[model samples]
Target chain A: MKIINFILFPFLFSISTFAAPTWYPMPAEAYKFGQLYPKAQQLLFAFDYGHALVYERLLQNRGLITDPKEFEKKILDAVMKILKNPPTVKVDEDDIAPLYVYTFPLMVDTFDWSHMLHQFVLDVLATSKDRGPAMNRRVNELFIDYKKNKPLAITDVCKTMLFMDGQFFSKDFRRQYPSFNLLIWSYHWFQIKLYEALLKPTKAERDIAVDQVTNDFWTLISDLPDSADFDMMPETRKEAPNFYKAFPLISASFDNNHMLHDIVSDILASKKVPSSEMRKNGIDFARMAMDPEAFKSNNCGAE
Target chain B: MKFLALAVLLCSQMLFANQKAILVNASPNAQFYRDLILKVRQSGEFTLPIPGAQSSLTYSFDFDQPVFPETLMGDIHDSFNPIYFFRSFWDKILFKDGSYLLINGEKLPLTCLFVSGQDNRFSDKKLLSPLLPEFVLKVYLVANDFSCQGPVKPGWPATGGREENWDTYLYYEIKDPTIMLPMDAKLRYRWNEYSLVLVDRGSK
Candidate 1:
């Protein structure tokens, strides 16, 4: 019996390992970034925090942490502050730990890459003036080097670029939870637009614009419910089509990206709702969006 | 010996009886859509095989029921993939699976399935007259299997941008086949979309 058990255990383990699902990139258009800039990284992080805060609130509520609203408010405040005053260095160790636990392996070691990319962009842009022709030549060389070393596939690159265009959707994330996915996408767009405003050459104008936008974006997102109301799925989508329309390439890459965001939020917010319930809710929302007859019958805000 | 034989026959019958089915419904409200699925399952209109079946199931929905003209169905298909207009960041997650189930009879070649509620809203109901039969509850079993990793996480310099991962499966089902309408009429209706992919064993 012991011998049989040992053999079965290993075989079972192997089956489990193999059964684990794997994720892949969607298309080349998903990863294009015309110009990598410092503010872009900040914008991305701000969006991340926005998503994180939502999940954090949900998880805290689930954990019996009273006053999730307070924590949510604090996190939103922090996000606003960051938007106003972007972080200079990569995220602090403490912040990374929470994010790591929430996002897990995907977020692991990613900050370093983001920081490196930002620094590289800053260095190149700073030299563009002094180096003139040399700067231009060096920029081309850097692009080539980055492509070769950290080469994102055409689809990946296009997805990134498409983010800039603000119209294309990410196929992967969109497939799983369209509402939450759109919320995150909208957050990204808000950040991108804010970054563009802040990156303007005039420092004074940038600062003022950043503060205004940050305040407005926070107010907009804060108005959203802590948990997704499954009944209101279509109404939410109709009201926020631009948010959905904005990030197609990135959305296509993974279903779990959006799922995890909600999962972690549920955990952090201490929402008692089971993961299965959340998943089912997401699936139903997806079906409603796919059915043409249903779409026509339902009013998504527009008459 | 006779009792033993009867027991074996009964066990075999039970084994063969095991079945699995997935039903998906969509609404403008995410919470409502979720509840609708639960309601449908509880209502027992469909029987799901226990011990789970070897095969997988999927369901999909579209929330934005963009109304297109019946006259332009051919033009829309000839010029571009109309799906692109409705495509958004949220749509990516649904396509993680290679294919999806079609609720209507409409035969969709692409992996994704489109649904909308807007069809019932049109004043001129005749627009959907041509394809009404094909548009009701239909199912499509995909011939190919495609697998991929989740998207790379968007970076956040403040917390070190994190990457995320997920596994997805796509399948389709046709719910109503009697409703036939022109391609343009079909595209004109708006509906909320949703989908379900069979998670591999132990995925939960």
Candidate 2:
């Protein structure tokens, strides 16, 4: 019996030992980024957190915050602070604060989506060198479509616009005040604009162009800290700068439409008692603001 | 009693003395002309050009589904490239000479061909084809900077040591095509940073 057991044991062990081998071809040392060009990968990672923070704050305070506009303001202010000081490491599961647990899942999901979108942008830019204007225009169209189709009122538009309006107002006031809708729009616009700038000219030229745009973007944000409305205003082709001339109308329309979406989302998301019993007043407002014909005609010109 | 045992052993050995060769041609027509003949020669198990043998051996090939990482489907929207995201966890074997063996004039997928090398006489019969030997070659595509030695093993799982350092056993048999004679072959492969060594059984 012991002899039989020994023979069977060796056979069983031999059968179990035949495991497949694995290989890791790419190593960590191969991954490197030069200092001159911005680290788009790292920036995209940071942007992910900024978007999450706003979304979490919005969802957590959804019912508690009585005033939608006021909530938007606070969230936008938070976004501005994040842009000013982005986090270093990726947000881990444990890093989610107690107040943000409810919205954390949604934020995590959106981060995945945003990361894919960032990759898509990189792929598109990498492929087309000379079509900067067309690509930028296409990106703008995609953003508009995203807003109209799958709009996230609190995070996508409001916080984005606030981040873009960094240099316009005093840093303190900008940090204090939040305009959630405008922040989303402005951030997206700047991101797309950066892509456009990077796609054109010689490497040196592109670098200079991005620096100038970055400076201009910061300056514009700094000048108008309280409101993104001024930033969204239309300028004649002659008055506008070289790159801005190509899509002045579209840019202006996007800014205003985004703000309108923000206000509507705020109203819908807010806890204030509605004048009407029907829960769709905010939706109705969004539809009116998002109307393409009205947008072409500058219907929200007064605001 | 000893004479009886010896007679029984001699009879058994004589019964298995007749050997048969069956060819499985899986190579492309272009490569077949060049490689098939060479492989047979290098294998040293069989002789070619039997009087009654068919011109080409028949075989079929089938592919198995690739194994992917468990996290792939859920994380489709993540930034990482989906192709390299999953580790390669499986190996598939295909006939070097891309063809299937004909058993009684019917082609069968090349899964495992059972061959008896004890037969001393060669037969064209499809059932009498000898089994082909198999070799397991362990390989690691090491990164440039990393080394096979020291505290950090170059090609190892983060928490575990080198996978190639693990023990593996290979079983093979060599046979004389003219007369059935089984030559037992055992082998093992050990890989370090520079190259892989294919060692015979019992060699450290």
Every candidate's DockQ is: 0.01, 0.01
How do the residues B147-181 of candidate 2 rate in per-residue lDDT, one tens digit apiece? 11322344568658654432221223322221111
C-alpha lDDT of candidate 1 relative to the true structure: 0.30
Candidate 2 overall Cα lDDT vs. reference? 0.34
Query: For model 1, how does the per-residue alpha-carbon lDDT over A92-182 read when each residue is reduced to its tens digit?
Result: 2212123223233323222222323333433443324343456445544543443342312111111111221122222322332344444
TM-score of each: 0.27, 0.33
Docking class of 1: incorrect
Tell how far residue A158 is off in model 1, in angstroms: 4.7
Q: Show the lowest summed lDDT stretch of 10 residues, model 1 chain A.
A: A151-160
Name the regions of candidate 1 deviating beyond 4 angstroms: A1-89, A93-99, A110-127, A130-187, A194-303, B1-204
lDDT of 1 at A261: 34
Model 2 chain A poorest ten-residue lDDT run: A15-24
Looking at model 2, what is the TM-score of chain A?
0.45
